[model samples]
Each structure stands twice: as structure tokens, then as C-alpha cells.
Target: MKKLFIAAILFVSSSCIKVIDPESNYITGDQLASSADALAGMVRAIPVRLVNYQNDDAGIEQCSYHGMLSMLEMMTTDMVVSGYGGFNTTSAYTYGNLSARGSNRGIYPFYMYYGYIKAVNDVIGLIDSETDDTTLKHYLGIAKAYRALFYMQVGAIYEYKAPTDSRYTEYYVAPEHDLTELTVPIVTETTTGLDVKNNPRATFDTLYEFILSDLKNAETLLADYTPSSKVYPSLAVVYGLYARAYMEMASHKNATENYMQALNYAQLAITTSGCSFLTEDQWLDPKTGFNDMTSQNSWMLACSISEGNTDGQGGGFHHTMLFGTETTYSSYGWRVGRSLNRKTYEAISDNDFRKLSWLGPDFFATETHYDDEAGKWAYTLRSADDTYVGNYRLTSDPQWLRNRITVANGFLAMPWIYPGIKFRCYAGNYTSRYPGCATDLPIMRVEEMHFIKAEAQYHLKQEEEARSTLKEIMNHRITDSSYTCIASGENLLDEIMLQKRVEFWGEGINFFDAKRLGLGVDRGWQGIGYSRYQGTYDIDGIAFFWTIPFPTAEEDGNPALQGYNNPYMYNTAMFTYQSNAALSQYYGIPPSYGN
Candidate 1:
């Protein structure tokens, strides 16, 4: 998918500026409101490029065999369309990279939130700068909420390992927003250029204190105001944000309570937003088929490419899912959607939606939406700077033939191209190419909310209620509960986590949920893994946290003294092994997660 449309107007300043001149530039009240909105949108945007693998106690999971993207590929490969280029790698590296930088990943935050901090601070300035409180409190509330959110993401993914105990320490802090700089840190306070380094890191206490303050303030601001749009952070998202913050603190008592608070807010969001769980009939709708038309269920979503969402790069209907098929884009350049391991592959029920895969005799033009916009997916001749122009064809590579031909569905192209089951947005003609037309990316949905509620209740031993909730999701999602497993006792938690993992594969919930619950990723065994929209993958090893790239390279040779780039390395001999369990053929994983 083309994610380049989030609308950050990047212009090279004559030189980086530090020490704000109130006259030269300062965020205003209106800017504060606008930036608050942008902050929400950017939060959703940050994760698209990265995946978290923490498991709290749930087993951790991740894919690190591939090299870091932003650090290397952006400087090297023109492999964006392949879904394995700089963007993916950059976002994927956000956790570690930002941590090393003493900040959040990518320029996304700096680019999106500096303006935010400015906006909020400006709002505060506006309140005191002016007379009546009026809406200033409201906007202030929003600004604070957004501030807490960005900090939470930065804190959880970047902070030094948990104190091993939550005794507040410097490690727990999120980088402080140079509020005067707003979200943009003044060069004086920030490391600029590549090698400068020397920016201050916020202590864990500082980060949490700020987050708590914001959420508490936001709760008051939101007390009476009922937002007309669910897209905005209704009270629910605030609670969700609070739960997220508490979890980062490892304050289970608080975290669990906040999670429940989140659920309440989620429920409110549904009522106010008109969102609902995916019904059996609407689970995989074709066009604007799914009930994705902003409802209470939509905690977050990138607007459809058709609807003008610039959130992802070249919206490609999430083509990275299907491996071994022409329809799946994993075959493009970067080798994503690599085949699933035997264990995970075997764990999938033949009846499960992900196991199915297909290709046609040749690619076609059936996909009208993507191709029409695709300059080429539409088959327009290359005007001039055509990289593959006259250089490749549907028949040019046998890998093409192998990738294109499928044994199922008469091996015929739909309309004219291939389509994956879960991700219905087609990538258009195999002969011609363009970014695929996937749906507005989902941030959260009733289905997952259902699972969260189910799991949370289960942990509290709301056994029967949890079981009932779990069944509601399965039956509502599939038409039959038989498709799901309902093991109690030792495996109950595993059962709940697996349901969530398979249900929300590429949507970005897995790693965090797994971490919070202390569930173990099935490097093998039943929870191994599967894919439909993303393609198959055997669990290589259970990685709980993203080994974010050490942006030492980006930070080196700079006056800012930005980061000490940490290489992506894990010593395997130290990993624990399930001595009695069998390991799958998929390589790189050690027997178990270890200290």
C-alpha cells in the first residue's frame, strides 16, 4: 500500500532552527486543535512500518532475519513496491531506533508531533494568554491526550528494559517534549544533523507523570463533551490510552483496571460510532463490502485510498499476505510472505480462511479500482522513466509462471487479476502493475474488542462469561464455533491468544496483547502461525520486543549525539528451549524465550 500520503509538507529548512523566537514561529490555538487531530492520525501511522513483539507474560514473537529497512534500504533499494523496502524496515526499526535516539521511531513524531506539543502548549498559552476559559479547556484536553499517547508509545517501545521492578527510575521516562519547541525540539535541546548526539533522555518517572497528567486532565475535559464523530478520540480512546500507559508501567492493578476502562470506552465508541463486530456475512466483503463505514467499532482506520487516506504507501490491498501465488505481492522484490513453517502450516485447519492460496493462468485487468489509479496497473504505456518498461512481462519470468498459476478456482483470474480471500482489494493485472487498493487500515474493531473483553474477563476468572464472550466472537465471525478451539485449564489463555492472533493478523494488535498477557508465542505447536492477506510464515523464534534498529548510523557524524546505533543481534545459545517439545523445520529460533 502507498502510505506516503499522510500529508507532512517536508521542506528543507535553510538550516535547523533551535530556540524559538515567539515572533518568528509559535503554534496558535487553532493550530493546537489541528495538531491534536494530526497527533491521533500520526499515532495510527507510526505502527504501519513497525511491529511490536512484547508478551508481558504471553510468549513474544517477531521477524528479524531480514535486515533493517530505513537504515539501509532507503539509502539503497528502490524496492518500495515489493513491500520490503525502506518504509517497512524503517517503521519496523522504530522501537529500537527511537530508543537508541532517546526518542520515538522515524521522523514521524518529530514531523507530526512537535507541531502537536506546540499546538497544545499554544492552547495553554492561549487560555492564560486570553480571558475566558471557554473551549480552551477542551482543546487543551485534546492536546494533553495526544501528548500522553505519543509518550506512551515512545515509553513502552523505547524505554530501557522494565526496571525489572516498577520502582520509578530515569529509564521509565519518555523523552520530554520541549514544550516550548512544542513537538519540535529546539536544536539547543535536541541533537541535530547526524553525529551531534547529546540530547537529554526523560526519566521513566518523567514520562509516566506526564502521561498520567494528560489522561487525568483529558478525562475532565471529556466529561461533558460528546464528540459528534467517533473518529475523534472519544472518551473511550482516552481510556484506551490510559490502559496503554498503565500497561507500560507494568502496573497490573492499574493496567487491568485501565484496560477495563478502555473496554468501557470501546463500548461507548461503538454506540457513538455505529461500529460493530464483523458479521459472518460481512467478514470479508469485496468492495466497500466490510462494515468499515466508520462506526463505533472503528477505534482507528486509515481512510480508503479511494476515500483519500494517505496513511500507507501506494495502497496495495495488503498484497504482502499470499506467498506462492501471482496475486500475492510478496514475490515482488523483498522476499516477504515467505512460506509458513510446517508446524504453523499444520496448525491451521483446512477449513480456516488463511490456508487457502491461488493464482491464475495469467494476471488480468479485473481489478478496476487499483489499476485505474495505478498509472500502470491500468496499463498505460510507460511515458519515459520506466524501470521495468519493455523490460519485463507476465511471461518474462518462469517464477512469474510459477507465481501466476494456481490449482484452485479454475486457476483463472478474477475479472483480470488475482485476489486474496482476506484482503479483497485486488492488485490489478499481472501484466501491468500499480499499488494495490486495500481497505482503510483498521486500528481496532469490535471483533478484537470482543477478544480483549473476553481475555480480560478470563484472566479475572469470569470463566463462564469469558467463554461466552469468546464464543460470541467465533460464532459471529465464522457462523460456527467448531472452527475455534476452546481448551480450558492449562491452555485456556493460549486458546484466547490464538483466536486473536489469527483473527487480527496484519492489523497490529498481536505483539502488544501477547506481551501484556504473558502468553508465549508458539514458535511451534498449534499457535505456530498462518496467513491469508499476509502470506504464510513458520514461527522462526518467539521475539517479544522489536529489536529496533540502533540508528547509530543516522545518529553518527552528527552534532546532536543522537544515538548509539545498536546492531540487531540475539545470542541464540542463551535462549531457553522446551526440552520435551518438537521444534519446527523453519529455522533461526532457539528452543525458548530466556532471561
Candidate 2:
């Protein structure tokens, strides 16, 4: 799973330089440009630093990016945290206990992405001064693309966009704030330490402009560059990143023009990369699912997991989310990982292959059963693949026994099981205390392009075109050609959103999408079960709760962030209810609760 291993080298400079980020140091521009090898090493350092999210401060409990995704996923109605008693579990955020000073929550990602930005800026400085070589220009492109991605992610959380956010009215900073009004602090390669330390946050428009500028530069530079691996930014990822960036900016600017551009760039990424949709079999393949990076033609970019990979603070996706153990790593216990809400699980058509990502009543009743002979389920429900079907014996401390029993009892009462088998563990293949949780984490893929294009087309009032595009994605996942999405009754936009929710599920885009579209999350009803994951799924009463709170630590340190944090809104009561009636309507039958 590990790709491009490079030993860390320190580049120290005595020369004075401006620092733009708090974590950046005195590595001078001259020192960075002095050696091409040094610059390349620094470039290599970008991804190396990016993958590590472990903080000894938080007991190495979370990886910044993955943990951010975990919080977002858990807070949404679709994904649920099943592990009730795990240390520093996401349950607090899932139940709407997010605080301005929450430990290992927003602070970790804020520092993580900014730290990445600082490293990227260092590379950009070197590239700007010393790089005329075509290869170096490609590295420049990579740096810029990554910078744009970080900005987009950070901006998505902090900045309030009026078009998408209903609580924009409550924001102290104006959505129409000019270039001088700070939204996110702008730190570039040219930014000096003094300037960075005292820099004011840029306005919403200014932040978007800065992000788009980086993407534009990257797109131009990477156009002809053939990428060595999917882990690095290819020309395709550049385009895809542009498409994603434009989609976010589209609402603020020329909606029609930006949507068209978003669609165009997405198309370019697909056509230029020769990436195709995963076949039905690949979709159903338990061994691969969403985890296998190389085999899926749709994968445009992924994070690699290597042997002895401690990049995730010794916790890979398996530790944070995977429910059952394949290898020796502690699993918290089966039925105690993340889970898709039963209402959301039931919305997918029975024939659709993606439906199998989560286990439902059908899986328990027909496809799998308790192996009385082995005193375990015939297969580890960790993945859908029959090859992965085997007993999961506890080789570690069985202290998790009581909790495991509790989860097992809850599983029987719930309609569907979650923390879906989408991410499979490398059990039989490798084993060590921290054996590579070697599942490749996906960043961008071609399947997303189809969804983005459909959403843009729909927004443009090209309903039929949107339906056609939706059908293109649906046709690949469903065997029935007779299926057609209608523009009536349930509405085409909702149907498209539903498909997106189903497609992206645990991938973490649903939360952002739900917020952008001004859609309130409704997890139907808290089930009869007593599990945390099965509770009432709603965070309604909190206005703008979707906007992540600015870490109090950040505000105290940076004078620029004072009074600019998104206001915290508590859930005094559940906001709205999305009934199973719509889900039943989609499947054309009332979903069975259980046996």
C-alpha cells in the first residue's frame, strides 16, 4: 500500500524568510532553491506529511483527514458510529456535542491541512525560483494542485457560502464580504513569516480566487505530464480538482458558466485518463469494493498503505471505521463500527450492486448465516467477498467481550447492519501489531464526475439531460435496462440526490453535499435497538451546525480569527423528519424491519 518511500532530510537555512503558517519554520527560499534534489525531497515530503494525522496530543486517536471524514460521516444521517465505548469515539459529534474547544475534533484537521499548506508553499517557493525543467514543472503542478485541494477542504468547513448555507444570515462575516474581509488566511510561497503571523483572513471571494488560481496554474502545467502513480496528482486529478472547485464557486459566480465548466473539466478527466466505471462484478467483489485502489478504473487518486505503515498514527481506515477484524488489530468488536442508517440502506433498489456494501436482513437470512459448527458467522462480515468469509477469533484481550455481546444482541433487532464491508481488511495477507491497514483511501474517481455532471445539468434546468446522466451511472450498477428515473412525483433532483447519497455513502461527501444543497439530515426513526448507531438520527435544531466550529485554540493564537468562527448551534430538538414512506416508495414496498 505504501508508494514512493523517501527518507526525510532537513533543509535548514540561516537566511531570513517570511513565514505564512504557524507551523512553518525558517527554511529560506535560497536554501530550498539551492539544490534541485532538495526541492524534490521537499516535494516528496508533501504527501508524506499529508498522510500522517496522528497526534500524541489526542492519544494518536485520529488522523486529521480521516478523522474529519469520520466526524462528518457520523454527524450525517447516512453513516453512524457503532462503537459506543471506543476511546475518543466520534459519538460526541454524532449526537451534536461539537464544541469550539473539542479535543481531537476540528483542531486536528485545522492544524493538519494548514501544516500541509505550509509544506506545499515551501515547494512552490522553490519551483518558482529554480524550476525551468519540465520535470520540476510537473512537481510544481503537483504542489499547486495539492494546495488547491487543501484550501477547498478547509474553506468548505470554515467559510459560509450564502447559496448553500441557510444560516448565512447568522454569520458575522458578510457572504458578499470584499477582498479585505478575511474568511481564510491566505498564505502563499511569497508570504513571509512575519506576514503570516500577522496576516488577516481573506474575504470569501478572495479565498476562492486564490484556490482557483492555484488550480488554473496546476491544470496548465500538468496538461502533458504523465503521472507515475495514482497517488500523485495526475493531469486528471488536476482537472477533477478544478471541476470540484468550480462546483463550489459556481453558486457565487456565474452559475451556468461554472456548472458548464465543472461538467467540462469532469469530462476531460474521464476522457483523458481512460478511466471507466467499475463493472458490476467489481462493485460486488468483496475483496476490492471501495478499498482496492489499483484495480478500479474509476479511481483517479488514492492514498497508499504500505508495510509497517504508521502514517495513520498506527491506525488505518480499518481501525477507525472497519467493524470486524480481518487481522490482529483491535476492531472495537463486530457490529461496533460505522453503519449506514437502515432507512438509507433500504432506499437502494434490490438489484443495485452497491446495496450489498451494507449488510441487511437479506444478507443475514439468505446470503450468510451463523456457522453453529464453528461458533461464529461463516464469514467475517467485514467484507462481502466469500474469500474473506471465516471465523474472527479474538487473539487479543477479550475484554471487549461484554460490549461485543451487546452489539451482537442489537444486530438481531436492527433491520440492517452498517460500517459497511466497503473497506476490507488485509487479514490473511499480513499480520503484525500494526500490520499495514493497507487499504487504499480513495480521493477522486470518475464515478463522482457522472454525479457532478448530473447535478450541474439538473441545476441548469436540463432535467432530461440530468436524468440521462444519472441513468448512465445507474445503468452500470443495476442490471435492469427497464429502469428510468422520472421527473415527476418524487422529483428528479431528490432522486439524483438519493443516488448520490447511495453512491457516496460512507465516503464523506454526503455531509458536504447535504449542507450545500440546504438539505436537512433525517435518519428516519431511532430503531428498537439500544445501540448508539441506532438512535434518532437528527441534528435539526442547530442552525448552521453543518459548519464546523473554529477551534478555540486557533482563535486565541491568531488575532485574525477572532470573532470570525462559525457560531455553535445546539440541537434543542430534532429539526425535521424524513419518513420511510419515501424509501418504500422508491423500492415500491414497505421495508421489512426484521425476522
Which portions of model 1 show Cα errors greater than 4 Å? Answer: 1-142, 162-206, 222-231, 246-274, 289-335, 338-402, 405-421, 426-439, 481-486, 518-550, 553-568, 571-595
What tens digits encode model 2's per-residue C-alpha lDDT throughout 273-324? 7898888766555455555677678888776655445444254333333443
Displacement of residue 563 (Cα, Å) in model 2 is: 1.8
TM for every model, in the order presented, reads: 0.55, 0.79
Clash statistics: count for each candidate: 74, 15
RMSD of each: 13.7, 8.0
**lDDT for each of the candidates?**
0.37, 0.60
| Model 1: per-residue Cα lDDT over 387-463, one tens digit each | 33121122124343433333232221122222223433333222322334333344445565566666666655666
